[model samples]
Target: MTAQDPNRVFKSGFVTIAGAPNAGKSTLLNRIVGQKVSIISSKPQTTRTRILGVCHRPGAQVVFYDTPGIFAAGDRFNAKIVGTALSAVAEADLLLAVVDAARPDPAAEELLAEKIAGRRLPVVIALNKVDLIAEKGALLAMIERWSDRRGCQAVVPVSALDGTQVEELVAALIAALPEGPPYFPEEALTDATERFIAAELIREKIFRLTGEEVPYASAVTVEAFKVSADGRKVSIAATIHLERDSQKGIVIGKGGAMLKRIGSEARREIEQMTGASVFLKLFVRVQKNWRKDAKAIERFGY
Candidate 1:
């Protein structure tokens, strides 16, 4: 007699999580995938494009794409942001219209209603940050409003920080997913490469160090990345290109102390991630008008 296995093959699909700036979209993604694929900050509009975070379960692979927050189509940059978010919704097998449960906005609801007007895909409303709501009545009211407007497949209350209802959310997402082969290896956590993560780490450090225009106009690119085969040590050289010399001075700070602190913090994070000694070398370069330079944008993987 032949032995029969009880476990059946599971399905896979894509889930796109998108919302307005500072809505805790990235925080939820990092929690769901259990890694930092996207950078987080108190600053609004930190994410500029789609960042993929993969989750591997026993019989399924869920590739979650975290897109930039949805704002009104403004300038070229803002248009790019809106386009990326909407594109993810259009292409995804499912979408999670993540809303900040603590601070529900009517504008965000209107945006969601407009998107779901003619779409056939199932959208699971992730009412995130539910822990912040003190009154249960307010939470229910928010849920009822969204359900009435868009008729969500599921309106799940969750705290992405404390991880309440996240597993159930994952299960709901997987159940809605279409059948497919694994999109990525089980061991992979993100679609971003080491170099991209390194640059992001540096950018994140810059975000923490300086405020205002410097963070807005700056971009980091890894000029060189080298690692030993045994994984004992790593060498990375990156350039922080700015639009003007004044921004560069602010980044470097008085006596270069600010830059040094930034480097130390980034290197420490890199070391923890790679479990290797790190030799981080940073340079401040002037790339005037890089954000508007098409060639520079392409080179930076934007």
Candidate 2:
């Protein structure tokens, strides 16, 4: 193959990653962007907001929006999350719908297809988690099934966890994008602020360490973020809000051991991301069913 010209046409556009809860949308976004722009956990609905991650290919710049998982809204909080995901559809030049091949949900898939049907943009379905499928026939069946689905331009089987065939998925998405200039600076990694990423890291630890409804009912807010005069260290103070006093106790654990563990792990991640030492202080508070309260939900930045 001959060397491509520097003046070759460059394609740049936004691609939104949407799927059901625990479908590995965030993982796929991180894999494609080569960075951790969105938090990940085994818990469903881990992502509550839209995160933008930029990828600069050889001849294209693909901006990805990692959206919250789309699901049936059962309450005010869930409705807001689902709304956030659905709203991104209008802003995207193309849609990359991620589906968990290991655990398929036809109802959720149908709903997602319906939302993308009228958008008139190309939709690429990624059959993620193919590594988890023990049988090759099962994987093939899933690829066939998604190929027959409506509104899908192409179906690519991939394993987001181990980066199996992710490059192909990226190529497919880039091919769908129209020729344009870069949407963001070439050096930009994400649109999220440092404080927001710190808060999300804490929440991810909560989701991983806590059990039952504790993680779902909890929210993290970074009240203070300070960098030392020398810029060698960062001081962060955050609060963990829950719906009940009992839930707070569960997060605090015996003699505050659990809270300490969460803080320790979160601080490490924050330091790694910022390349500076961190002093993290955590406090637990009860908001008394904040998920149901519209004002509280808004105040928490949901």
Candidate 3:
């Protein structure tokens, strides 16, 4: 976890967060990075890709990868998502293993452990959502449990929601990094483009506003992103892809009210992200059973 030289002036490396669904990995990353590079929701598997965020400090820059949750998969689609979660652990110089202390799932934690077992990377466990646990003894017991886990360099309890012990977690991660110069520029927060973020913001609205299989069966793609000549506003044209024809009416809503709600909420966030007023155009289209087709998943940028 340290460079060969004891007096190295700088340190930089990648830290990938691996854990179960709704473990607060994305929330932790957003808090540490101080921006909304990854969207958050109560739903599992909200993050599908390798979302990269760069944390720039005075002497170090820690790059982070927020991936899909680790879960037991019985189908092709879920297996792909689980693969993305596991792949990130191997590529980083350090790993942050997060778990929900209030709602412990031994099965999911064990699955996460199995994937990272016997790896040489520096591992730090963050028992997240500690604020939800009222009993001090329970927190102590859980802390002891994770401390005994093999291959862990540090065990720090945190609450990503209220900024409790998060700075301590960040300090632990920075201490484990090897000596190197900053990997990204000082002003840079993430590598994601505006178009990709706009699409994700739109998808986040669907996940929060809709229910059942509608969120899982849907994806977003940006067709047009054009800035005006004076650069005061952005005009975006995007489509919400659905796996079944029946889901279209659900997203479109009665008298287009649902779509209007999703669009208005998404546009405001995009405005905050781009610092420009946005004119967003959303459309719904169905490609039958797209999740069942591997080619369709790839085409959707999954």
Candidate 4:
């Protein structure tokens, strides 16, 4: 075997994205990875688990961990989700704190500032959703506010939805990471399995189409996944767990029309993601206050 050249430099490390709910953290992860590694929706707390998105650059490999939004944990489940986000902060080589520039939340900003305080890791504040801010002064003020609050190493304004200044944000993050070999293969985009992604796609549709608390009380689990003989098609059977029977009825809707709509939208997305025909079967069941039950929450992989 030949000896490796000492002059060849590579930067690779984990970058955790943490922010308040609906702050565009997941959107940023998807945009930077050039794929939909994390589910995105307007509803808060849509992401309940840690999602890893790997970005392979010319001289760097960044494994981005998209965490649940940091917020006040009013219940056991909420606390678990917040704990997941905080744990991600502790494992990062660099921290990208995304903040909504258009509608800045002081409490959310303060929560992140406190978590990152006294940490040795480099922190970069991503002032996200800049496209929504029509006033240049407001955007500049937001940048300054976060800079003063977190004392981050860099503040890069970006709009993850429209790919505005996203490359610049990536450059900033890569610059902060230390040089090392790639942590993941170049072909790998995320650590999540196909089953998990399919389930998330279904949940995302529910969050998008449903109103009120039904979306928040819902969870999807892929119970069965099968591939056709030729591998040209995929079949998935998932169960959507609801906290109440009424919610189940809401998800099913009249004549099962709502469930069909959710299934059709999710199937289309899954097909696009897997590059194969997808037959998605969705079933709704009441779990009886599953969110409040620790056992049920663990069973659902929250």
> What Cα-based lDDT does every candidate model obtain?
0.83, 0.91, 0.91, 0.90
Per residue, candidate 1 scores C-alpha lDDT tens digits across 1-302 of: 11122455567888888788778888899999998888887787777779999998767789999988887766564676678888888888888888988987888767866875576778888899888888978888877877765436788899998999998888788877887788887789997887788888898888878898898778888989899898799999999988999999998999999899889988998887778899999999888888777777767666
- How far residue 51's Cα lies from its native spot in candidate 4, in Å, is 0.2
Which digits, one per residue and each the tens of the lDDT, describe model 3 over residues 61-132? 899999899998888888888898888888989999999998988898898888888777778999999999
Q: Write the per-residue lDDT of candidate 2 for residues 89-200, one digit (tens) a residue.
A: 8888889999998888889888878877888878899999989988878778778877876666789999999999999999898888898887788789899998899999
Clashing pairs in 3: none
Q: Which ten residues in a row have the lowest lDDT in candidate 2?
A: 1-10
Candidate 1 at residue 160, lDDT?
Answer: 90
User: Which residue pairs collide in model 1, if any?
Assistant: none
For model 4, residues 1-302, the per-residue Cα lDDT tens digits are: 11144565788899999999999999999999999989999999999999999998887789999999999889999999999999999999899999988898887788878888877678999999989988878787777776775447789999999999999999888888898888788799998998899999999999999999999999999999998999889999999999988999899999999999999999999999988999988888998989889999999997
RMSD of each: 2.8, 1.6, 2.6, 2.5
Model 4: lDDT of residue 108:
79
Give the residue spans of candidate 2 off by over 4 A.
1-7
